[model samples]
Target: MFVLPDDDDRQFAVTLARGLEMLRCFLPGERMLANRDFVERTGLSKATVSRLAYTLTELGYLRHDVEARKYRLGGGVLSMGYPLLAGMRIRQIARPFMRELALQIRGAVSLGMRDGMNMVYIESCSADKRSDTRPDVGAVHPVLRLAMGRAWLAGVGPEEREVALNQLRVGVPDQWQRYRPQLDQAMRDFAELGACFSHGDMQKNIYGIAVPLSAPVDSETLVFNCAVMDHTPQARALLDDVAPRLIAMIANVESAAGLRQTVTTTPPRYPRR
Candidate 1:
């Protein structure tokens, strides 16, 4: 039995929630899934999963593959994202600045927001003429492992950070162990420098530095990161020089957005057990 929220004013929509969950079952790099896959992922009955799959396919949210007997995300997902993407003022305001920063660092810069355990890229700029480092707008990186995520977590309230950490502890215990120490240090770095660095933490050869931004309008914690493919002397210089610039850029953004209040003090750090 599905448990509804305890709030009396909240109206629950079971079908809608299940449909969204079915959609979320498709992870990064998973191009296709069967009804059985949805059933396994969601713990829904096979019959219910089949019905939902058919309904979603008819609604243009899922594309059915007749030959492969699978379903992939359809164009309707783009429609769902377009309005949200279009309305993000930060992305619009940060574009030119990100472009300039990318060019200055001769690498890639991105603005990201936390989505569950992942940091979703909302906007990106690449200095490479070929745009080799540019990630897709909706690309996601693990929150505990990426520089942007660390910066974001560093800025969020203590309760929210604890909730997220608890979720990590329950969901991905091994990863939580691997990342706990680094995250603690990143929290300290963010407290001292207002920025966090990831030296080949996410990708083997890639290095990145990130700073959090205060988004008062929506109360969303956002982050900006500069990523380079390799840890060279140039990368080290960029990390040293660009991190301060990144913090200043975020301050400029907050000022432009009329978010006068800043999160100067770091949230209480989570202890490594």
Candidate 2:
């Protein structure tokens, strides 16, 4: 279910929010969904789901499957993201460095920004053979599950970090036990090294290391990550060596983008447990 402000909240548009919530029901690898799926996911009445689906289809935000009776996201969704992606100065400034890092590690490098409870990839550069789980622009992953997200959480202030972590715990209670220990360790690692690494935690055979980057031009916190598909010794060595390089690359990008003076120190003030 999606969260919505109370009716008393100012400037809240219920219909528009519900429409967007319906769109979010289509997750990664989910190509199509029927009206019933929306009803079930959103806990809305069948009539309401049908109406929302029809409205979205008419607006071109969703494409109706005439033969299969399903709906898929349409070009309209891309329209919403294009402006943001095109306007991101950090993506432009970091692209060349991301490409170089990918080529140097012969893997994938991505820049992502936090989106609600997930991290959304805004820019990605990949070597010839990319990891199976290597996400492209617009791909979303759980915030606490990926190295990029963990690094970002590490950079946030304590209160914000606690809020995000609490959201994760409440949203995915089943996985909290397994995630807590690793998250604690990542906090320590980031405190010491300014970066953190993950080995097949989010996806088996996918290894990654990430560092956070905060640019002066944008309020959003972004992270840079280098990833490899294999979990072999070679991949581990590459991850270990590339992490520091990734940090340096971010430093260079921040310097070029005039963000060095704005970057915050590590182990950002956290509330005592």
Candidate 3:
């Protein structure tokens, strides 16, 4: 294998991301792991795993059982993540509905919420006929790439949406600018249309349509979206059909959550492009 002499500098970040991926390898089930056992499952070199394990332990994100030489997620992980998870309990309520939508549309469905300047996918369900593009459950996608981001942006207050936009601009690579104007226009259009759709933003040949979940009483600022890369001759028609259904779904979710069950069926505040 040809290795660059300066690869060590680049290696540190890759190692950190790898270690995080290792943590995810252990899902909600199979909660514990032994050193020897972990190495085999993660496919990471034993030495690297050892060092990474020690680092995680120190950070309180992972803990080891001294006697069994086994490891488990540290309480620290929960400690750091509890409140966010608590707030996103909407996932528990929205999952079934999202599943229903996916079944109805024969597309991938997702329920999302805003976190800082990004749209976080709390739940996603892929239809049987459409497979291969697997989006990790907790993964976050840039707002400019998909309808989820734009839809949520439309619903949030200006302060929040602007801050999120600034953050996104900084986080994304500079090379992605060819689509910058288009994204800005989408955001503006979403504000007017009360929803958003996209083609080839995050991935080539992929398409998405999204709408802000109607906050029950308060009008939630987050979005609900559906994406498909499977196969479609008329992506636009499918997206349009999905929008009204998405609005009603959000209304159901907000009412169930008791956070905002009185949102007005107000028309989109922005002008059509």
Candidate 4:
């Protein structure tokens, strides 16, 4: 669930936050949602949901479906994202490399950054054109569960990392309790293995290895990952081959983007848990 700002905050706009939160009710893979759906997802009153939905539809942020009595994200929502994507020179610089690596490993390679308590995919490349399993751009995954998110959590400064951890501990206690051990292991893996691994954890039959960029991009922490959808015995052996390749790729990206002094394969140091 997306968290909203406190209503009492001096700078917080209550009605604006409510409308935006209503928009966030649409999850990935969902095409349309009715007012009742928003109410259920957001814990808002039926009347409030309807009002916000109508307002969003009128403002061009949502498209109304008269026949279905539902709404889908509109062009205005998509248009807002273009500027962000266009300004990310790293995304443009990393795509070709991501494509090459995706082809090499016959898997999917992605670049992502933290968004609140989740990691959102900014770019993704898949080895198979027809594969539906690979995450598309804008896909969000829990930070405590997936390799990409774990890499971001592992790469940040201790203070920022602790703040996020505290948020998780308080914001989503059940998830934090369930996945805490895996989070600890991820930190150790980053410090010792140079990459973090997630096998059949975040999603079933998925294998992933991720490493954070050696340096921040535009003051944002970025993570690069390779993911394969497989549950066979061969998946175990993928770690060794993919880890070094991912590290090499991160070094290349950091060098090309001028985010580091020199291209080095040494992993970023993570705080000992």
RMSD, every candidate, angstroms:
5.2, 4.6, 9.0, 3.4
Q: What tens-digit string does per-residue lDDT give for candidate 4 at 77-130? A: 999888998899999888887888787677889999988678899999888877
Residue 104 lDDT in candidate 3? 63
Candidate 1, 192-263: lDDT as tens digits:
777787876787777778888755447678889988777545876555667766766666667666676552
Cα deviation in Å at residue 219, candidate 2?
Answer: 1.2
Q: lDDT (CA) for every model shown? A: 0.80, 0.81, 0.67, 0.82
The residue-level lDDT of candidate 4 at 212 comes to: 89
Residue 118: error of model 2 in Å? 1.3
lDDT sort, best first = 4, 2, 1, 3
RMSD of candidate 4 to the truth, in angstroms, is 3.4
Give the poorly placed runs of model 4, Cα more than 4 Å off: 1-8, 231-234, 264-273
- Assess the local accuracy of residue 197 in candidate 1 as a C-alpha lDDT between 0 and 100: 76
Which candidate has the top score in lDDT?
Answer: 4
Q: Model 1, which residues run further than 4 Å from truth?
A: 1-12, 129-132, 231-233, 260-273
As a whole number from 0 to 100, the lDDT of residue 104 in candidate 4 is: 69
| TM-score to native of every candidate shown | 0.86, 0.88, 0.62, 0.88
Candidate 4 versus the native: TM-score? 0.88
lDDT of 4 at 142: 83
Q: Which wins on lDDT, candidate 1 or candidate 4? A: 4
Model 4, residue 237: what's the lDDT? 64
Please provide the root mean square deviation of candidate 3 (C-alpha atoms, Å).
9.0
